[model samples]
Target: MSKYWNEEIECMSREDMKKLQSERLVTQVKHVYENVPYYKKLMDEKGVTPDDINGIEDLHKLPFLTKADLREAYPYGLLAKPLSDCVRIQSTSGTTGKRVVAFYTQNDIDIWENCCARAIVAAGGTKDDVCQVCYGYGLFTGGPGLNGGSHKVGCLTLPMSSGNTERQIQFMMDLKSTILCCTPSYAAYIGESLKEMGYKPEDNKLKAGIFGAEPWTEEMRREIEKSLGIKAYDIYGLTETSGPGVSFECEEQTGMHINEDHFIAEIIDPKTGEVLPEGSKGELVFTSITKEAFPLLRYRTRDICVLTREKCSCGRTLVKMSKPMGRSDDMMIIRGVNVFPSQIETVLIEQGYSPNYLIEVDRVNNTDTLDISVEMNAEQFSDTIKDIQKKEAELVAAIKTMLGINPKVHLVSPKSIARSEGKAVRVIDKRKLH
Candidate 1:
């Protein structure tokens, strides 16, 4: 059971990794400039030619691609390879105007699976393990990405898509699943379900879990680990960048390691678009160097995090990225204060409330209001009105201390809030600022 899937690439020196990225980036840029007219137009407007981008140092000269750009480009605008060359397409679960669709050739899928294999192996997966993939299949990238990776690792793979909790548990107990892959929220729900079924955390055979696809706090990770009796690892990715194996946590559990051979990562000031120095907290940007069907150059991920080349005990030389703090586009601005749902979640978990909570923001009479509905755990749920009000006030004060703004807190009964099988919807903003 080796700790790494590919030791040569994962442990490549910084100098050699940069050289590989430069070569791939140059060839990828030329391919996109020659084939993708929409990206070519953006590069032309920015006065950047393929020759202008010689290596990673010149990456800042390229135009940034945002979600809006993807929407504007629509179905075929950003396709670098021809339709015949593309073998599959995975879409973002965004419910907004246009869903982001990413295309992949067979080679692209192979590379993506290899990236995911690195994630699994880093999590202590082996050929003898049973990898249960509960992420949604078909269009969603989570299931397919981990599924292919499990196959590549020669694990006995179970393609159990999201939802159907009872069946999931039955399969887990029967087949003795060793590795579980899904979003963090869903993992929590599964842990709760197993406990309710009179099965202790030690009863299940699951040893490690890979959770991602939503923003979660460290508190939630500890809670899940306790409930499931497994070491929880975080995997980070987006559909545009070839899904959940872009980077992953190793045994060190410090931060996720980015696969620099396939993609180059950069952090930039969100407002000014200036690339930030290393260890600076800023928006994350990714450039797909090896992607064939859809090689996005300087794609603005909008995720707020910092990257560090700090050496890891896991022995991989890949750069480690802090778990995303929040999204620049999703951060709520109320009464001129920036609030992220993760901040509220931290308070909830610390206050002995369930991680499942809803933040509703609305504007009334030219004033913004913040209201939070938190789920009280079975032990915390109370029957008396005064007791509930007292708990709510305590949460209000705690959240005020954390966010610098008071919010009306309502504690609901246990399991009152809807649980999501996919990315959990934590915030609902009714203000029409657009």
Candidate 2:
């Protein structure tokens, strides 16, 4: 079996990759500057024109775009192609604000699917495999992206858009699904559900899982891998960047390889917005070079991570990005300290608690308070309040040691926390910060 879906491009030399990126980026910039008035305005303000950007080296000259810019543009402000040319529109969950609607031309869709197919292939997917896609469909990009890619790979795709866990498992067993795609949290939930349904990790035919759409910890990754008896690979993307195929993990299991031919990845100092050197952990930024309908240049992803050009065992020369540590916007400041949900999650998983947990932040008596409600596995659940308190105290200490800020820990019953087939709600901040 071929190890790569597009070996020619995936393993292209750095010089060739940069040349391709430069060419596409030049054309894309002209297209956006000519068609998208909002971005043109941004560029004009920055005194940058298409003539200024010759190649990837000049990418730093482009102005940055943020979620705020997308919201300001709303439905069609940043569209480069006409609605007639756009074949589809995939959107964000709108949980943060106005849903970011991304237009896709048929060519755009083809390239996006090709990117996804690369991800599936990296996860060891082949035409003979049954690829089950459970990401939420409709406006959300997860379902459609993987679904298209599965078809491209000639896998018998199960477009079982997220939810209905029982039906998902039934299909998994009946059809003998070889690859599963969904959010990491949902994958964990499915793992927990399989155990409850009297199925061992190896009972099903699943050999691999491609999980993304939400931030997850390494500990959670190992847990899911053990529960499903499959190598759980991480895929990363946003609706703004045409969904979960912008980058994907390979057998190396180190970091996701960004599809650099389609998108240029950069790390920037979050506060100053200066592009950081390679290996520096900072805010992640992307510039879509080939996207026709809605190409975003220098779009700030708010994700904190590093990028490395280090050669890989997989032989793909594409740049690899560390799994995002946390989003700049998602970072919580409590008691004059910065805390990320992933840090808390790491502590929970290490402490042998269920990955399903809730973090609630609030202010009382003019002081910020942090409380974490962690679900206890069946074996750990006890009727004794003192035992529970002791466990909670231990967890508090562990978390404090990790985060440097003490958090009130509440151990709750297994299955008490609401299960989500979509992105799991991890934090609920009640503080009013204007």
Per-candidate TM vs. native?
Answer: 0.98, 0.98
Candidate maximizing lDDT: 2
lDDT of each: 0.94, 0.94
Off by over 4 Å in 1: 382-384
Error of model 1, residue 11, in angstroms: 0.5
Colliding pairs, model 1:
none
User: Which lDDT tens digits does candidate 1 get at residues 1-434?
Assistant: 78899999999999999999999999999999999999999999989999998888888999999999999898889998889999999999875567999999999999999999999999999999999999999898999999999999999999999999999999999999999999999999999999999999999999999999888899999999999999999999999899999999998888999999999999999999999999999999999999999999999998999999998998999999999987765688999998999999999999988899999999999999999999877678667989888999999999999999989998877788999888888999999989
Instruction: After the best TM-score superposition of candidate 1, give how far the Cα of residue 311 lies from its true spot, in angstroms.
Output: 0.6
Candidate 1 lDDT (Cα, 0 to 1): 0.94
lDDT of 2 by residue, 56-146 (tens): 9999999999999999998999999889999999999887767889999999999999999999999999999999999999999999999
Report the lDDT of model 2 for residue 224: 98
In candidate 1 the C-alpha lDDT for residue 128 amounts to 97
Backbone clashes for every candidate come to 0, 0
